[model samples]
Target: MKNNPHHPYHPIIYVRGFAATQSEIEAAVADPYMGFNIGSTKTRLAWTGQVKRFHFESPLVRLMGEHGYRDVFVDGNDLVAGDFADQPIPYQSIIVYRYYDEASNDFGSGETPPIEHFARGLNKLILRLQDKVCANKRNNVSPEDFRVHLVAHSMGGLVCRAFLQNKGLGTEKARAAVDKLFTYATPHNGIDMRIVRNVPGWLSFGDANNFNRERMANYLDLPKGDDVSIVKHFPPERVFNLIGTNSRDYSVLRGASSWAAGDASDGLVRIENATTHGPGADGRDVTSPRAFVHRSHSGHYGIVNSEEGYQNLTRFLFGKLRIDGILDIDNITFPAELDKYHEENRAVRASYQIESAVSVRKYPWQITRREIRENSAIFRTYDQLFPGQPGTKRPPDRSMSPHLFSVFLDPEKSCKASKSVSLLCDLKLLTPDYEVDGVLFLKRHYEGGVIYQRQILVEAIPDTNAAGGWRIKYGDQENNPGKATLVAESRPLGDGDPASGLVFSIPIQQKSRPGLHGALRVEVRPWS
Candidate 1:
């Protein structure tokens, strides 16, 4: 609802993650803005094996600097100090929910409230902020037009969702007032441990029940008996989940929690379970727009404090262009000797590690980066994508293949006032496994195989009102970037199936398998 330049921005209500222990809760309550005010300095290891230091001045600082937002903090007193006489603050305000304040020693009996209570508090927070801002005449925002964006981390994401989706808990008007929601390393599906997997049903110690899938399903009011679904209270595209893939770097809990979370996680939440999910229009229980990052759950390398998270947050909130990348496979080839077995009507297994990295036109940081070495690989698999038997089912890859990643663009800021924004994407297909002579040789089992890599250049129309979604130009760097022929065209996500994303093509070539006749079909959709 907070649309256009006059009310271009929405108040960012930051809800922090879970703090189980007393000391942690106390610390969380003590800070006015909570951890939203924290900053970090870390290393960015370059391709040349050299490291460079980058300082992320915290999301609060970036929002203030880039969007002209200001903190509620003022000269030794609150804004309400002047008898409610202040030139209504900008619509762009940063608010920390302070849900944890009740649990602090300085506050009420030092008890944490249930998530539903937090959700109710969120509803109140929204109305209260609307009343305060609307009181300022310069803002000129109507009562019904006031909107907010939720920026949350860890368990805080659950609180926001509860406020939006849980009917018995959060009011509908408050949910409607929300423009968009973004999460950092949130376990939308209950947190699953390596050994125990999903949180056990009996684990109802304090807020521990908050992580149980069944209880979560009950509280969030997902369709009964259907655990994995995007709650219908909000549009699926409006919520963006930023998943952390680097579990080892999470230093909280003495690294035990990270180890317990195991692989394909941000040390606390697994990649698979960290997004808002529900039945998409295509009837699949798909997650909303989400991307993987090589960051942990919380800490210096945590999702909230990293450059990847910051870039995604800013772009998603303010960007003018959105793209979803999907991999399309036309044909796959096997080595000559291995091809002989396939001709013999034998069982051969293969799965692909669809690796992708995409960067905005001019932003120095990559928006979505995934590689095998980083333990972040999108695995597109087939027990038999191509089968010899009549009963063996080989589904169409493009129709349902998972989207690789998405890139959001603020063309003016990123592309320097260009009508078109360009993205340089690096896509690699790793031979994770292959079957030979009726024997399966996994990626680790084999020494060498054709590893395909290609550079894809995408030109997206910066204006959302533009006629077409995108124009693809393909060529090696050795040739002219402009002369590159357009192989496949792209469309906006809404133009196709709700589950279907933007589509593009990249010809797969390799010295070992030059005859491989397949183009990496990619699809992208505009995300909220």
Candidate 2:
């Protein structure tokens, strides 16, 4: 069947993560789907501390059941190996990139190959899939139109990046065939430990040097000073990073890995290192779309097996609408005593924290969450926000402002009765404690205080006649629960093209001495 323009369902290639031990490699080679079929039976409710009976039937099964996607393996035989007389496969099919099979003793040589070999293997696999998929003339898919989505976990993301970024590793045709890339708990910036810092290049046990930044720079073909997360060859906007924040649940090494990786990690990959960046339309390096879930790195409670991960994966692969949230700060007020202390020219240091929790209306779980308690809140220093003018009341630089969350909404997945997409952003700006001359100023300080907090609910009602193609309405859920009474018309940003999207600004202010004045700027655009 021909793919829909609005909701294109392309073939998905699952790339499994790293397997350090020989036994792990053998186990990975044993599984037909390479752990992509692992599912979870229970989930912890955020609002209530109850263990819910939510069953996520794995990404493989869910994709097959929900979207009518099929697997390449049929009747215990691999179709990619020419098992069924060159039978044509459906366009919406799942193919597991079993790169580790070559490293296993049961399948091939016992020696593990480098990441470049895996990239080359991925290139060959894409070409083979292209041949198999295009063989079906009834599907009407040409070689130029054939595309595939890369869904990976952990170190697998690096392999995909190697194929796309390293020109010498793969052909341009294979790179062009990638439609979108989604990663789960990938250490894009390289792994860091409490004592070890960056994994040393000399650490060759189980080829642990693969997580080293120096090795990554070599495989990813990144420049000396450039970050490994920067996507030079591929369209970075099409990539989605799904970060996990629950380090406590990661049982790797009997929880030793989590302790060493610290609290701001997903038990393995640090939160700050889990995202990717690429050049935006304005030529500035912008962060790709990412979401944070309260899951572990890999295990029974791993990111790949969670519902939050699957939901984000399906939406990014097939969703039609995209929304980006950013906070534009006009001014951050200080306490009266701190204001006097700041005017005295004594060194006063203060840093602000911005916490955001996003979810669709009627959903029980948050799509993206960054909270102070979770240790994943966005932090900014006083000088960083207001460069060269620390104590001044000047507005923060717009470029330095925090990008809260990027969410993709599928209109087809919306409530059948309402038929509208509703997004709720629970934003909070925590008040910072002041320190004068390296001394703590706790005169009137209270623990767990916020300068600004609100629940802004936005509803996008589809309208063909509307200027921006949607009727927008907003409401402060904290003040009026479950109501969207205020009308917010969409205004064009830049040239007003559908790709440029429409901007909707919601004014936010506290007006108190220690307050926050800003606008939560939301940009909505049509996404494929």
Candidate 3:
């Protein structure tokens, strides 16, 4: 047997359910206030049916199994049902769960446990999973090498946030192990399920007697209290969030009358709660959350089974396949409405309104030109500069000096022009292909501008570390006359010099190697 070096030692373990515990039922049934067995929450029963019928099918099992992982399905209600210590190593796993209950119109009665309490229980479950994986000698995966990505429907997202931000979760490394999290329709803020009228002290599932709106508010980490805000605490890089939106209505209250503004929802969870909160910072958060749209909510029960939901689940679990830095969309642009606004207000704004007479209006123009500066026989090599000699000038047919051109900025590196006046001169080179050369004009462009050239060289540098870049030295070009004269020109019609073109030729240099490439830099001089 052979294992790849990049392979992880510990398999991914999935945990399922906000399951029922015998103790809770025994306590609820024994209470003097209740006459009959209210039983477990309807949501749990619904989830149980869904998981048995679809989530544990051959397709899903085979999908995860092929990746060298074992699906460890634990009963959320049983608490100690699944094998906590006997899971496969170096495989992806799952931990499925559902809401505590479907609270009927009965306030101050038996209700599901508090979400934060459930979150604490989940932390314990994770620790146990880690302990089991560590015991296997074949498991070489460290805590850092492994990651747990969560795929939750409805209330699952809230549970995840509580786990990360809760003081009980301990240090950052523990939090980091959970690399990605996708919530189907988690309500970051409280949902408008109308619990106020039905269940008395509905939010007080953890502690019954002292349960009040204020105390429950503290447990839920509302904006009012000191409870840690998951959004504020967790960085965006570690989480992946998804949301489901639909027109279906499942609200038993007021017959779907104004269910969180009524227009968009997955029948229960609103679209507003599907993705992360607010007009967020202009960036992505891998850790905190991300969201995607779905046509249907799958009736809450069928969320994990439907085609759209499953595809999203798999993509969220696996890292997006990279093919030239694109995913789902080829390219995205700002709304056309915003673009129109900017177009209408293209003029530079003064501190106050500037006078129309004082401000100069601008127009756009295009220019093109061609020239033959050297004989084909003498100019055999590729390294040549255009507009090389003296008294050679190209008319300004186009010019847009006021327009700004900014450099590219990325996380890997940041760069700006070394000088204020960064110039980009595009020069075309003509060459003949060896295979069929009656006289094929192989045109190519080179860039050079007066800003801040790092080294004083005769040739131009490349923009990226791709193919086709040349840097000519002072002695590289042939100086002997009767061969070819290096000529450069420009054509700016409206925003640039018109009739601007360049031509130059150099003697072909024979080399033992197949290809020749080098670099050069121009000296930086302060602008006057």
Please name the candidate that would achieve the greatest lDDT relative to the true structure: 2
Per-candidate local distance difference test:
0.72, 0.86, 0.34
TM for every model, in the order presented, reads 0.88, 0.95, 0.44
Error of 2 at 211 (Å): 1.4
Clashing pairs in 2: none
**Candidate 1 vs candidate 2: which has greater TM-score?**
2
Q: What CA root-mean-square deviation does each model show from the true structure?
A: 3.8, 2.2, 22.7
Pitting candidate 1 against candidate 3, the one with the higher TM-score is 1
Candidate 3, overall lDDT? 0.34
lDDT of 3 by residue, 1-528 (tens): 023233322233232222234444444334321211111111212434552222324224545554454444444322222454544433444333322322212322345556666677666656655555545556655555645555555445556766776566444655656655556555454443443421234444433311232443455444553222236345543344444444343443344523533445555544444445321244432223343343334333234444334443543354221001000111112124322432454321101000000000010110111112211011221112111222233222112111111111111111132211112211222222221123322233122211111111122222233121111122221243111122212112222321221112222222322221121112211100
- lDDT, candidate 3, at 243: 46
Give the alpha carbon lDDT tens digit for every residue of 1-528 in model 1.
433344437888888998888888888877777888788898778677899887999889888998888765566444421345564556788888888877778876777778889889888888877788778777777878888889999888888888788788867777887888899988888788878878787876657778888778776887544254355677777789898889888887798888888877888887778877665666666557777788888887778887789889987887766666666555566666556665676665667776788766546777887877777877765543343462354445455454777667765664444466667777777765776545775534544343676677766543444334445555554355523456464444544653334556665554464133456555545443
lDDT for model 2 comes to 0.86
TM-score of 1: 0.88
* Backbone collision tally, model 2: 0
Q: How close is candidate 3 to the true structure, as a TM-score?
A: 0.44
